[model samples]
Target: MQITQKIPPFLERNLGNVLIIAFLAILYIPILLYWYDGWLNKSINIEHEYFSHALIGFPYATYLIFGKNRHQWQKLPNKNHPLGGFLLALGLAFYITGSAELVAISFPIIITGVMLWLKGMPGLRLNGFPLLLILLATPNSIPYLLTPYTLPLQKFIAAMAGFLLQQLRVNSQVDGIYLYVNNIPVEVAPYCAGLKMLFTSLYVSLLLLHWTGKISDRGRVITLLSGALIISTLANIIRNTLLAVFHGNGQHKAFEILHDGWGGDIYSTGMLIVIIGLNWSLDRFEESSMIISDEKDDNFNE
Candidate 1:
């Protein structure tokens, strides 16, 4: 038997190609401006912020290059179709106003919007892209919508770290943003909260879902997000401890290294590697279980 895949009626009608070209233009033009500004202002550079910022536009670029999910955009109305472009513009505008961090965070939502648009969910999955993008992006950089949660999460994590330190008998106390350990001051700032890693972890989780195509929609989200949260928390603890130790040594080097983007990059990259490894391992186990189940079913039939 020959297997045939279904194409959207709109695509069959030539509407899909038109929309793709138009959206492709829309996405690229603003992205170009975003880059031009970055170059003129020297925000994200080839040396330091090179891969970090370039990776932000990966989802849309990937979708366009492969055209694997282009048909999904056919389901959206004209106004709703290019949702990612609008958010990208908004995010770019925010960046221009001296909000580079927010801009970086906004990339997640924008990318997510583009992904969902390509996937072509029923109803207004367009709106959902922005929301999901925002959810994933919000924690990574500065929070624009739910700014309150940032502080709460930071404090909660810091407190937990302090408790853990005590359990380990390392003599630690939570003093506002400072973790006092044996009269040594350890600062728990926003950067040290592993926000970048948290955001990166979430991105990796989404990438896993898209790549494996093994897990159900619900399972993909639940498992990926659970792993992300766990890994993010662990990364945060490690980052906090590093800060405490480095600061205690009377060396302000970590901040300089972190601010130069190396420390954060190393930590975020490490977290991503671990998360990907976990996803791959779990997927392999799941596949093996399914194969075993299939064999059992065949044996029973025999």
Candidate 2:
């Protein structure tokens, strides 16, 4: 005897939608209960620093995910897997442990489990980068972790600024992280050390690479990210040097303007422009090389 199993037509046809709705519902409760405060705090923290601009990546990621999945949603298979179940349990356990950082970190796992259960591996592949972008919304705290490196960075910036000031015939002396010009002390604060800018630049670089489709190539992606980081650091150093010069020269108004006003905004904007421009140029170069290679192959065949 042979046994046959069948799915009802309605259930089979609407399974994708039903699974998606169920997945969202499953994610909603835990996220709201366990992770909302962390997200709120992240939003609050970005309001007053270089990281403020990185908040844009959240909506951008949402749009990217929606755009990526909009056409494929109906094609997704509705299937449940044992791995998805395990991941879901693990994510919940992390959330229930009441560690805010862990909860924030677990979101992608939870969402991945839902996607895998709903649409299997294909869904996970399609949503991975967008899902990972959620981590960018985690509050920026790398500065605290890199506190050991801050003093050295501050000292370096102060020294460089002092050297530049001396080259310009302005008497300046570097005392640790302080640059004294005409005996006016200019402290190289941690904020001036560019940690915040570095973090923001890295986030923006990743977002750009993902959006531009360059992230598919691991080598190029690493190169682009490294370039972005270097450019950001250099830009910060330049800004800090200029600020030091202004403060050393006893230009209090100029220093304050650059530190906290339109001057600061302009400098940040310029740094971002340079970073984005470099990324665009690198992507174009890659595309051009690919085209040239294809043409060479065609010629060789002919």
Candidate 3:
């Protein structure tokens, strides 16, 4: 049967969105596939396990975009904002560089511009996090950029773990980034420096702030971020100490389990719960103060 020549009413209303979606799909599909292959290959190697975060970032962003917020997509008005025009042009410029990292950066900028061109600032404010989260997903220069600065963190964690081991009556020594627990040398590699944990925890804290609609409260946001940083740092120190203890005592299976297995996952989940709990406690305190103030106002009126 011949198809009708007429465009559907829905398509008629959303032609611009359809075109933009098609263009983005063309631009990003290959980039995503490349990273997916890298993640798959890296998953088998313990040293490169950080690449696995690339696997979840996009899927989670997609969830945020189309799962909870799907209804808002149709409400945008497609008139280009001046800022959006500039951003779109800039993103297009990056797209021609033939560098995967630049191209990944371009995706978020292009998405930002598209959102602005379609619905302006309000739309961006509503849906910006998912696009921004894509920055963490792609293969980029993040590791290279972060490596030089990671030594300090590595040294610090090594020192802390050594101290913990000594406190636990384990013979330990700390020399630079090497920790000797019962003289079984454990190197605190750059990847073990806790920067990834810190970065990941900070990002998750941002997610909580955005979801809770607490992003506007700068004081609370800063407070929450600071708390996340401290919690993640301590958690990393504890994790490393335990791993060293396990390995020092010749508990190879336990060391491997905690190093990159279910033990690590459980530890991470526990850290996440602590961060969430901090947020919850802060909110409860604020609510209690407000209620107390209300009661004081009622007493003054009486």
Among all candidates shown, the one with the greatest lDDT? 3
lDDT for predicted candidate 2 compared with the true structure: 0.72
TM-score of every candidate: 0.62, 0.72, 0.83
Model 2 spans > 4 angstroms off: 1-43, 46-53, 81-109, 260-262, 283-302
Question: What C-alpha lDDT, on a 0 to 100 scale, does residue 68 get in candidate 2?
Answer: 63
| Model 2: colliding residue pairs | none
* Model 1 segments more than 4 A misplaced: 1-66, 70-145, 164-171, 214-216
Instruction: Please give the range of 10 consecutive residues that has the lowest summed lDDT in model 1.
Output: 137-146
lDDT of 1 by residue, 1-302 (tens): 99999977867787655675576457445755665465335484432223333354354344533465345554545444466556656655665666545655555545454543444334245334324433542323233333445676678767877877788777668876678766787666654555556656776676667567643578767977898889888878867766665565566787566544467667667788888888888888888999999999999999
Q: Could you tell me the lDDT of residue 161 within candidate 3?
A: 82
Candidate 1, pairs of clashing residues:
109-133
Segments in model 3 whose C-alpha atoms lie over 4 Å from true places: 1-5, 33-77, 81-98, 116-126, 136-138
TM-score, cand. 2 vs. native = 0.72
